[model samples]
Target: MIIVNGDIVAQGSQFGLKDVEVVTATVDLEEVRSYRAAISRGLQAATSDARYQRIQTPFELAPEDDDADIEKRPTLPMQPRMHPVEEEIALSGGCYLWDYLRRSGTAGYLVPLSGGIDSCATAVIVYSMCRIVMDAVEEENQQVIEDVKRLCQYSQGVLPKTPQELCNQIFTTIYMGMKKQSSRDTRQRAKELAEAIGSHHVNLDIDEVYEAQKKLVVNTLNFEPRFEVEGGSNQENLTLQCLQARIRMVTAYEFGQILPTARGRPGGGSLLVLGSANVGESLRGYLTKYDCSSADINPIGSIDKADLKRFIAWAEKEFDLPCLHEFLTAVPTAELEPITENYVQSDEADMGMTYEELTTFGRLRKLNKLGPFAMFQRLVHDWSIDRKHVEGDTAPHYTPAQVAEKVKRFFHFYAINRHKMTTLTPALHCNDYSPDDNRFDLRPFLYPNFWKSWSFKRIDMELKKIEKKRASKGK
Candidate 1:
């Protein structure tokens, strides 16, 4: 019997025999028999125990039924466990970070809160950890209680009373901004979210730091780079942007190491720097290498953009942090580029693909096992009249050529940025199609931007045929 929310629910030991049979079909009959016998012995021991005998069984055999017949009966079809994916992700990521902190003897987590969906999700996951620990303490989980005590450095018999108190102890958020690069709106958002989560928040401007670094580079090279708006070349623009991003990374680590001491705790303890790059951005290679993406651990790295958005929406209600709703309306930006009077930079615009499309491309490339040409072929049908396009076309249809171009462009960037994955922060494995190089994705890092084989040539020919067919239909 199980009690949930004040209601008593009968719980049963149910097994999916069909799933077991599928597994047994791959192994030897003797091995299957041995496995079954081991399970039987374990069950017998459990049933014979006084504790087990006191518990009521969900199903009971009739008095007239023979024990042999009961044993020979097939196992019942078990009910599949259904839980919200968002809740599961929160629990998994929260537990992972909590365990990492406890095992590594780290003080807590330090996040560079950019007021973006990715960073917001990472912060909430840390907040979730506080909630989980509070629940464990309430339930009197001794191991968790001991771990929390040591992690938080609480006195004997003193436990955290609320999630906010635990959060202030464990999580630190820093919004590193440049006057010209980061928006006031985003900075305010980060500040409000930090307050909502009760984290130790710091708002620091790095304009002088950025200028100093730029001057040093200019002095060394005898030249300086500028943004594209300032008449700089693409290389110059990228170099300048990367400088700001790399500097933020450096600053984040410094704070992560000293935050504990700053809070009046003993020296030598450091917080784990958390990364916020999602799987969709990773798949499209839309992030700067060694930037915030190069942190100690990324809680939401394996999650897709859509899922992260959903999680954000869920968090707003679940955590009672309504400030998360701002991210939904806010445009996603790196804020590395110079802010113009009229021009605004967006993540989708920079990547040449929306987060939604990136999620589709990632799923096709990994989960569906589709390469460039195959993906192009499938997407032509999948993203037909009913689907949205990158160009904001709502004409209820996309030509085959448009779909092919989208596919080609996606693969082109995916290959060029494959090397970035080598240095990608270790991310929590939440999705089936994770592009993390450490474990979930094991493809070659060095790949040609475009396929250079006969099969690829054949796919090109097929695409041309498709183009021709579409032209004829138009006529």
Candidate 2:
């Protein structure tokens, strides 16, 4: 049931199957995109309305002492202090999580916290979930109170007094470290955030299990693998990296299946394994297939990296989890490769594209519905030195040739990694554009090698037009 223009309405009620009606209504929610956007519009209107006082608020973003821009503006002095859009971004993710966990019978959530921004964001959402539940309880929301009590297994007089107490009961975090790759810093960071949110934390290295698997693979296959830093081939390096990721995924599930009982909880139920892959990484296919990306649910998956980072900065203050500050500042890495003084793996460097560019690519591809050649044609104008269309574009200015290459490189990797999305965890429908294959963005996973196709030829043809134009001017 949902409110339409302040009136409660039920969808698909004509069907005899009540279950189908509920499933169709809540599942994916693609049919109601306009409705959700309308609600955001309503909030936007509320912020700017003369009657309501402005309040900056997940519920973070510190307010400016002086609204210098507002003060400067003679008109529109009533500009809202809080951005309703960003507030919806954080709240939409948390609200869906609470809805899912509350209705679905589960012990709690199990997050494979890698101590990176993505995972930290996922953990923070759960913390936000706890806060949402408590807020509901404080408002004397009886339905939410019943769900919370049942999920927490609180009986009779026993009840959750705080978000921390509830979080400790439900949320669990695990950090699987490798002997050669994992960092001490990330481990400490994960522990600190878990403590800040009051989650039950587990820290252990998978090196012993990793070594055993390596030994088995070596003995059975009569071959051995090494990392790139160890003078090994590219294939070996990737294999080793994927091995760690795959191991972590399996370990996460093993723990999720048993953590409830292991923690001496009332029930021996399974926990939902939450994925941390953000929208940008999913678009660029930066994650290992069936690694942590393959999970029961992902809250931050549809949201892009840039906004996710902004949300984290906001959450640091809003949730009062200061430990989130480190996550915001720390460089992003898979930590799959062995760490060396000169050679720790960086996610952007490995992808050969920045997260910012990935966001642009994702928007153009999914939202603009642009093909490779069309993307180059469009971006060359926007990202060119002249910045013809995008006056405020922050992207690096590039020549037509360079822009073409970047577009090709992104599409090439995206094509090769498209199969991975088939198994992408069901992420919340929060972003304007999502590459989620399960429901939202549907495209052919298989594509012909467009490198030698008419697309590339068209790109070359377009580049010549620019070069010829420049050459004529010079002459």
Candidate 3:
């Protein structure tokens, strides 16, 4: 029912109202977004009358009311203001999985659990799915029970007994580690986490597979590549690392396609594979194309690293999974490089930027829609030590030259690796800014380096001005 304002009678002809079917009163479309808050205020205003006649549309909600309309509007009780979406991000993620499972009729879910927080957060979300399923069953939600019985292939009178049992029935976690690159601590952490979550777990060393994959190039080029720690060049190091990373994707699909039959689940089917690449890494383009980032669906693709860590901490206490605390303290690593006494590969070190910085850069570029010059302009003051624009600021201290250099470096890596985003797995939408090119982010995979652009050249011009200004101030 479209409500047209009584005063705007002549203006109603402009909207082509025939297709709309109902145009009783007119409204300001701009105010529609705040309609919820307005309803709260209306309820507060009408607290005395018990027969609360709720206004159906914004057209009926006028700040000042005349006698005729006020007589028709019943008063409602004033209530405490509250938002129903406080836990929407985390809870809605689980709901996304459940919705997909029932609609698609997938047997369950499979995750390439790498013993990192990204994958760990994915596992925790699956556990939350189990919690949601059990809660539905306990509450006797008939529709959910019917769907559960069909998915689990349970006979009449049999129902899910616990979240752990439901998890084991629906979730499978595989840790594909290499003897040389994967460490004992990460391997053990994956095992402990799976046990805590009650997922069907598989653990194996893929050193043999890693070596065999390398032979494709080794046999063709008559070359044996080694990691950086093993005296290999940067090109050779990256080649070997990608070999290990891609192997995980191949293994995940192979297991996902056949796990139902192997487990004797009655119907032969496949599980929806989960990807764990966080938004910060996706933005930095710090992932290999078609590596483990390729999956049936990604839960953390849009969620940033800092928020993912906070979610993990929140899940540890809320879900009672003590094993998650270790992931919080553990250093973030790709674990593609060999673990050594002298060298442990850090994710931030490999990418040449921290996750926090990536978050800031991503927001400035996408959310703020700032290009190279504009981003440098914003960050110069934001990250400047001397010019603390906001008091009690904790941003990293950097000179204008340093800020400009960092900006150029980030856009360089971001531009070069953008091709990877074109294939980034479709992730759950939890964040405002995401570089998942396939879904939320839509941009060209190929482009000239932003450093060469006119806006970028202005950074150097700006830096020279700042330097000259500082030199004169010293006099």
lDDT string for model 3 (202-268, tens) is 9987888888778887899999998889999999999888888898899999999999889887777
Clashing pairs in 3: 3-25, 4-24, 4-25, 4-26, 5-25, 5-26, 46-76
Off by over 4 Å in 1: 1-80, 154-157, 386-397, 439-443, 451-456
Alpha-carbon deviation at 92 in model 1, angstroms: 1.0
| TM-score attained by model 3 | 0.81
Q: Please, what are the lDDT tens digits per residue for candidate 1 over residues 394-415?
A: 3325667677777878887878
Q: Which residues of candidate 2, in runs, are more than 4 Å off?
A: 1-83, 154-157, 386-393, 439-443, 471-475
Task: Name the lDDT of candidate 3.
Answer: 0.80
How far residue 434's Cα lies from its native spot in candidate 2, in Å, is 1.2
lDDT of 1: 0.80
Candidate 3 shows a clash count of: 7
Model 2, range 96-197, lDDT digits (tens) per residue? 787788778898899999989999989988888888788778877777777777777533325688888888888999999986798999999999999999
Backbone clashes in candidate 1 total 0
Deviation in Å, model 3, residue 24 alpha carbon: 25
Error (Å) of candidate 2 at residue 381 is 2.2
